[model samples]
Structures are given as structure tokens and as C-alpha cells.
Target: MNQAVGVVLLSHSEELASGAAELVAQIGAVNVPVAVAGGDAKGGLGTSYHRIQEALEAADRGVGLVVPPDLGSAVLMTRTVLEDHPHHDAVIVDAPFVEGAIAAAVAAAGGADLATVLASAEKARSVRKF
Candidate 1:
């Protein structure tokens, strides 16, 4: 069986991350593994390296992992976590938080591989409304 790619959503607000995950599930990616890492240990609006690390571990299920951060600091924290955990099969995508997570999750639900899922998330950058 093909392993579905996993997604990790990072945001400064726990509600934002969890809400995005829920939206992704509602959008038909319920089977895909999506982990959320948002807010600090004290439940403040900030990213936590430890929380991100835990989310990464939880999201990765033999398949590769995709990380999309909601803010610049969250992105930096995710990068730091990945740097520390060099063996993780993961990539950090530069894309909008909600759109990227939903796109990646949809691709993953279709059993797309790591690269494809990452591409899907990055592709969200070109999404425009005219």
C-alpha cells in the first residue's frame, strides 16, 4: 500500500492551527495525518519548538512530512526543529497557512508522496482571485 504524506500545521495561535486541521478534514482529507503545533507551553500566541517537534513526530507515519507555518516566527521555529532533527523526512513549504495545509492534506489523502504534497502546498502561492 502507498503511504500517504503527512502534514504539520504551525501557527502562533492554537485555535488557528487546530481550526485549519479541522477544515482540512472537513475538506475530505480526514484520512490524512495532520498534526497541529501552535502556541507556547503557557498557551500564549507564539510558536514552540518542543510543540512543533512533537507534532512532527505525530504527523510522520512512515511517509514524509510537510510543514506549513502561519507566521515568520513559526517558520523559523519549524526550521530550527527540522535542523535539530535532521533524520526526519520532512520539508518546510513557503505558502499560506490555511490554503497550503488544505492543499497538502488533499494531496496526501490521494496518497501523494512527499514531493508531490510539498509541491501542492507550494502551488498554493500561485492561487489568486480576480
Candidate 2:
């Protein structure tokens, strides 16, 4: 069976990242590979290359990975980690962190492929909040 796409939430705060992941679960994104990459090695508020790498490994299932970074620093860290993994099927999408994570997680849970999942995440950038 084809594996579902994975979604990673990269944030500066561990609590924020985990809370977002929990929200995805509450939204019925069951069985999807959702990983949280947040905080530094000391468990404080900061992005870490190591944490991002760990999240990538845990989420990836040979299908693809969609990471939505919560801030600029997280984005940079994710990018640096991804650079080392040249052959990995992954992408750092420029989208709203929570909204994109929920969208991507739902799509992945529905067994969508990489392209579809990627598009779904980016589409969250247009999500209406009004």
C-alpha cells in the first residue's frame, strides 16, 4: 500500500508545535504522519537543526514530507537540514503554520500524494480568516 504524505510543524516553541499537532488530530487527521519539530537542545524556545532532522526522520515514510515553519528562523533551520538530505522527497512550504499543518495533515490522512499534499498546504495561505 502506498504511504500517506507526512507533515512536520517547525516552530520555535515546543509547546506551540505540539499544540498545533494536537489540533490537527482534533480535526480528524488520523493515521497521518505528523511530527513536531520545535525548541532547541536545552528545551527552550528556539529552532534547532537537530530537532528538525529528527522530525523529518519520524514523519517520512518513503512518500514525501511537508514542513510548515512557524517563523523565519525555523524556516532557515529546516532549509539547512533539508540541504543535507539532498535526495529526500520533501519541501518547506511558505504557508500559515497552523492552517497549513491542518490542511496538509488532513490531505495526507486521506491518502493524497506528494503533489496534492503540497498544493493543499500552500492553498492554506489563502484561507479566509474574516
- As a whole number from 0 to 100, the lDDT of residue 65 in candidate 1 is 91
Over 1-130, each residue of candidate 2 has an lDDT whose tens digit, in order, gives 5688989889999999999999998998878888999899899999888888999999989899999999888877787888896527898988899998988998998889988999999999998999
Off by over 4 Å in 2: none
Candidate 1 deviant stretches above 4 angstroms: none
Show the colliding residue pairs in model 2.
none
TM-score for each predicted model, relative to the true structure? 0.94, 0.94
* Per-model lDDT: 0.89, 0.89
